[model samples]
Target: MKRDLGRGGIVVHPYRGYGSRQEVFVMGRVFRQAALGRAIPHHGVLRDVADVVRRIARHGVAGVRVEASLGANRTTATTDRDGFFDIHLPLQTPLPQGLSWHQAELQVSQGDDRMHCHAEVYIPPPETDLLVISDIDDTVMYTGVADRLRMLYRLFVQKAHQRTAFPGVAALYRALHVGADGEARRPILYVSRGPWSIYEMLEAFFQLNCIPVGPILFLREWGLSWRRPWPRRAEDHKHDLITRMLTMMEDLPCVLIGDSGQHDPEVYTRIVKEHPGRVKAIYIRRVDRRPDRERAIERLREEIAHSDCELVLAADSAAMAAHAHAKGLIAQHDLVEVHQACVDEG
Candidate 1:
């Protein structure tokens, strides 16, 4: 899908890479300004329409060179027609997993297209006790992702700094990262159905609100084009991604977090059933007000009865924190901090 060479200029779109002490994996895309979009003034519904139009006009540049560098080690690959590239490099000297986040540079080059950018490659510490995998939309923030029009309004209308997170989410995540004894940097990974286009905005949202920094994995590129559905559905993508994360670290068990506004309950329930004893707990924020939705969650509770996994449909972060504390997922002091954070938000 070779796109036209544009005066819009080429930009490097490197996602936050992930790896361990042995090697590092890097992934990114190179596209015109129209693809990732320029920081232009946009307002309301019309702005949403403009975003879609830009994506439809975007294709990709083939055979662009990409170089990924970490410390003295460097690796290279070329972008496909979709302008995407991924490279796995074995290190002569492996990085210590004690380092929470490792900095890596990605340099993109073609005939006239040349750009250099930085990507944060994440490596979970060796002492990580419990892994936390969470969703971004309604689970962390106030976005109505299950509702498309409302999701559009919040996404396109608000700036990154202006977007609001659910109360006490940052504190809850931090507590999970710094385990029960408060000495561990338990790995916390954030997953989203959203495209790679909003990576900067999402990163800003996390940092601005004091959430724990970890590898943020997005399932695909932007879904703006009306071409086809997506590479895969949301439920399928999330389940597979989480499964890979769990398989990556065999010793550490995970606690999954999401909202009731979407298919989180269904996806997570299946995961818990498939891999018994792998998931510690499932915390889902009760977003939908409908009784049928509530009953749907209750049915999920019955479905997971054969397993020891606890499915909690909580009303707020405070309640969820209390539940996690009682379940020994977090410490008592951590619960207190989460409650205090909620009070501060008010």
Candidate 2:
């Protein structure tokens, strides 16, 4: 299929390498106007089915009641209930090959109006089977500016409007979650000491940073000596969350990325020992000065020494890439090499 995108241009979605009888699906939502000013409710938007029509223009046919792009030779079904469209073309169907490219366009005709959106779909590259579990606070994000006072302020008094993923974080995570070929996998779970009250703020930060979304588990404020909602202690709260996530991904090999600023090393070491095959590698980012942090990391490493996972300290994304490459987790050219790749993408 070919589409006249614009002046002196065309587009196409080639059907190659896809197995016969397989469903070709393109999924997303469409919204409609409601009142005069307010945005349409996300959940209330109705789904509209789009028909895919393919045609080939010949000298004999002039305007023979054409239905859609190409020339109206075939018809596909409407989108799903979620406003998603699926085009299923069988292997028996003969494809056009003379053009420089194949074009696929979305055709939606409702009431008396007609809309056409064209796209060129190409097969994506392969992705690696690697999981990247990261810590919050000073590790994946920045919260070290004000120390405990700042932390307390952000938790209790003020909202976390300033939270952001560190440099290269978004790019690195996006690459891990979605492969270079554009196939997105289950993102690495976030185990943080952050409270759940700022869920909206944290969610917004993820969006602003273009970080891949993941299930976030937070800790309570039990350690503050006040506002203790849960009976379990603070350390126990974090430890339990980490254990559960580690267990959840037990079948998949994962990398533990965190900083030496907190109890990540300790918690990760325990998880490695408990679930020997789960952890593939551990990368600890260097943080602010803490003389005792080294001893703590050493002890944690000693505890997990029996595990097959290797632990290293990375000063930047390059170092992390080195570790990932050595372990055959990701390609050396992956986004991990870009320092602060997340911010770089922006």
Q: Which model scores highest in TM-score?
A: 1
Candidate 1 has which clashing residue pairs, if any? Answer: none
137 Cα displacement, candidate 2 (Å): 1.0
Off by over 4 Å in 2: 1-130, 155-161, 179-184, 221-233, 340-346
What's the residue-level lDDT of 22 in candidate 1? 66
Query: On residues 144-232, what C-alpha lDDT tens digit does candidate 1 reach at each position?
Result: 87677777666655657889999899999988878778888787888877766566678889999999987788766654545664334
User: What TM-score would you give candidate 2 relative to the actual structure?
Assistant: 0.55
Model 1 whole-model lDDT (C-alpha atoms): 0.79
lDDT per model vs. reference:
0.79, 0.51
List residue ranges in candidate 1 displaced over 4 A: 1-7, 34-59, 71-74, 112-114, 226-232
- Specify the poorest-scoring 10-residue window by lDDT in model 2: 48-57
Question: So what's the TM-score on candidate 1?
Answer: 0.85
TM-scores of all predicted structures: 0.85, 0.55
lDDT of 2 by residue, 1-346 (tens): 2323222112222221111111222221121212222232323222100000011111111111112233233445553332323344332343453321234455554445455565332211123255567887777677773377776545443334456556677666665665444453534656667643344466667777777665454655232224643324476666676665445434656778888777677777877887778888888877745668787787777777777887776665556666665665554466445544634543
